[model samples]
Target: MTTFYILVGYLALLMGLGLLSNRFFKGTSADFFVVSRSVGSFLLLMSIFGTTMTGFAIVGSTAKSYTDGVGVYGLMASWSGLMHSAVFFAVGIKLWAVGKRYGYMTQCEYFRDRFESDRLGYVLFPILVLLVIPYLLVGVIAAGKFIQPTTAGLFPEAFPMPNLPNGNPHPLNGGIPPAVGGGVICLIVLFYVFFGGLRGAVWANTFQTIVFMGTGVIAFYMISKNLGGLKAASEAVAASDFGAERLGREGMMSKLQFLSYCFVPLSVGMFPHLFQHWLTAKSAKSFKLTVVAFPLFIMIVWVPCVLIGIWAAGYLGPLDPGQSPNSVLGRMVGQLVHSPVLTGLVGAGVLAAIMSSLDSQFMCLGTMFTNDIVMKKYGADRFTDRQKIWIARGFILFVVGATYLLAIALQDSAHVFDLGVWCFSGFAGLFPLVFASVFWKRVTLPGAYACILSTALAWGYLFYHDILAAKPAGVGDEEMLVFGMMPVAIIIAISTVSLVVVSLLTKKPSEAIIRKFFV
Candidate 1:
């Protein structure tokens, strides 16, 4: 009960802080969407890093590491740490410059202008929304999974879930069910985002990043101490027959799989939320810290979560049949930390990491709909600043409702890591469009269109064949990988070929169009 109250208190404090930040809101659409483009260096870094490292980083990594061994770190964190920073430096800074110059608010706006096609937004807007919803689902699913187990046994009498015929509590029986947990989180995020907009998200992200990271360090320390320190923990894992292979290269991952994972991080280059964050930078110099420190931040969050998951195999032993891999982290925290107060704090930290990213994603979707769809197609001049903000808010509420429904429906679906990879792969497949639009002068509007279409077709086919089909029988990454490689590799290859082949074969853009973007 004390733990539950602590969790509630933490959420209330966050909501208050978020609503209070509206005092600084300039009450314009620009301020709501991009914070008047006045965000400083440190806030920009924290916000970018925080938004990127959502439940996918914490919950997904722990679950994957537990299932695949320590090699999960190399498959994602190592590559992402290096690739994410490189992409930020190479792609983010350039986009920020163009966005500042052109007064662009969304990724589709940049594409529409760069390609000189009003219809491009009509095509790209739906695709971007399609990709972003999965990302949002990952956060919602992970938050429910985290909260469900952490709050278990607290209200067993009131919220009694079905149990086994043998009288034991069901593995999934808990304090709050997925629907309620997801709904509460969505409402909190919506309140802050609705009032404070991007400003609220950035401020909330900065605060949540500190809370999660600081408490993450404490969780790691206490877990290690409980298990007789790092040395003993490693030895126990090494000695356990169940997880001994996790300590070696052969048991972790294959060479091709490891190399293919590198492409997954490329998805960051095309994230709509990330694009919005880049545009919020006060100057190009604001990106310097983000590029340098992102890898370190990845390490800070990933290493502990990965290590904890790896230890869980030895500590908790084997899982029962029909159990969720996502619950491993929360279960471990609950068991390892004997103090109820400590358990609540650790749970709050995990929730912070999950929610920090959700706000940005939800807000970005709203910004895109208002700026790209309503204002661009319908005309911004027709709507006042407050009206525009309301338009965005209304669209965002619709999105929130849709996503919440999906989160509930897919509660028993794929692991967070796999779902996230599928989502990121869709974005990564479209990376060629952005990369060529900036660097390659010959890329035509037709080529961009081809890239979008090809990527979407491939993503849809693979997702249905690999994920949705196999999900019924509990198939996961082990069964989903094609020839020991991920589906992203195939999608990227197809998208790149479509872009290049179509661009060379088609007529080039007019000189003025080329000069506006390229020269």
Candidate 2:
């Protein structure tokens, strides 16, 4: 009960902080969408770092490590630490400069102008929304899974879910349940995002980053202490049946699989939310800290969660039948830590990491709809600043409702890491479109269309066949491969080839359009 109360109090404080940020709101669509392009170095770094470290980092990493062992860290964290920073330096800074110069607010706007095609915005908007929604779902689902187990038995009487004839609690029972947990989080994020906009989101992100990282270190230390120290924990894992494999001594992942994982980090270069964050920078110099320190921060959040998951294998043995691997982290915390206060603090930390990304995603989607669809199609001159803000709010509300419904419908259907990887793959496949649009002077509008269409077709087929209809085997069971490689590698290959081949075969863009982007 103390833990539950602490979690509630932490949430309330965040809500209050979000509302307080409304004082800084400048009463314009620009302020709402990109914080008036006035964000400085420290806030920019914290906001970018916080937004990138989602439930996918904390919950997904823990679950993957639980199933696939320590090699999970090598699969993502190590690569992301290096790749994410490199992308920020190579791509993010350049985009920020163009966005500031052109007064652009969304990626679709950039593409529409860069290609000199009015219709391209219409095509890109829906695809970006489609890719972003699944990423949003990953965060929502992870939040529910993390909250459900941590708050178990705290409100059994008040929130008694009726059991079915077979003795199950229908969807869930005893704990907070994924539906309720997810709803509360969605509402809280909506409250802050609706009122304060990007400023609110960034401010909340800065604070949450501190809470999560600080408490993350605390959780790591306490968990290690409880498990009889790091050395003893390693010894316990060594004594387990598959100890060497868990410790990465037996080459758990194939060489092809290990190498394929490298492409996954490229997805960051194309994340819409990240693009929005990039446009918020006050200057190109604001990005210097982000590129330099992002790798170190990845180490801060990922190493502990991965190790904790591996330790749980030796401590708790096998998972119960029909249980979600997503619940591993919460289950470990709830069972291992006796103090309710500490448990509550740790729960808040985990939620901090999850919700940090959710607000940015929710806000970025709204920014896109407002800038790309509503304002662009209807004409920005027709709508006042206040009306534009409200329009964005309305669209965001619709998105929130749709995402919540989907999350409830698909609870525990897949692993958080796998779902996230699929979503990232879709974006990563489109990286060629962004990379070429900036660097390749000969990239024509037709070539841009080719890249988008090829990525969508390839991603759609793979997703339906591999992810939805015939679900791939779980992590450690077998690799989910198309022609003996990850789906993203195939998707990227198709997208890049179509981009280059079509650009060469088709007529080039007019000199004016080329000069605008390339010059």
Give per-residue CA lDDT, model 1, range 1-519, as digits (tens).
888888899899878878888999888998999999999999998898889888657766788788888888888888988999998998898899899999999998998889988899888888888888888998888787677777777777767789889988786565788788889999999889988899999999998888888777788888889899999998999999877877766856778888888988999999999999999999999999998888898889889988888898788777898776777777777788778888888788888888998999999999999998889877999999999999999998999999999899888875644667688899999998999988888999889989999999998998888656646555545635667788889899999999999999999888887778754
Per-residue CA lDDT of model 2 for 1-519, tens digit only, reads: 898899999999989988899988889999999999999999999999899888667767787888889988887889888889988998898889889999999999898899988799999888888888877888888788778778777677766777879986644456898888999999999999999999999999998999888877788788889889999987898788744367882466666776787778888888999999999999999999999889899999889989988888788777889776777776777677777888888789888998899999999999999989888878999999999999989988999999999999887675544666688898999999988888888998889999999998999898777556754456443557876678889999999999999999999889888777765
| lDDT scores in order | 0.86, 0.86
Measured with C-alpha atoms, the lDDT of residue 217 in candidate 2 is 79
Error of 2 at 397 (Å): 1.5
Clashing pairs in 1: none
Error of 1 at 329 (Å): 2.2
Candidate 2: which stretches are off by over 4 Å? 161-173, 249-251, 412-419, 470-479
| TM-score, cand. 1 vs. native | 0.95
Q: Compute the lDDT for candidate 1.
A: 0.86
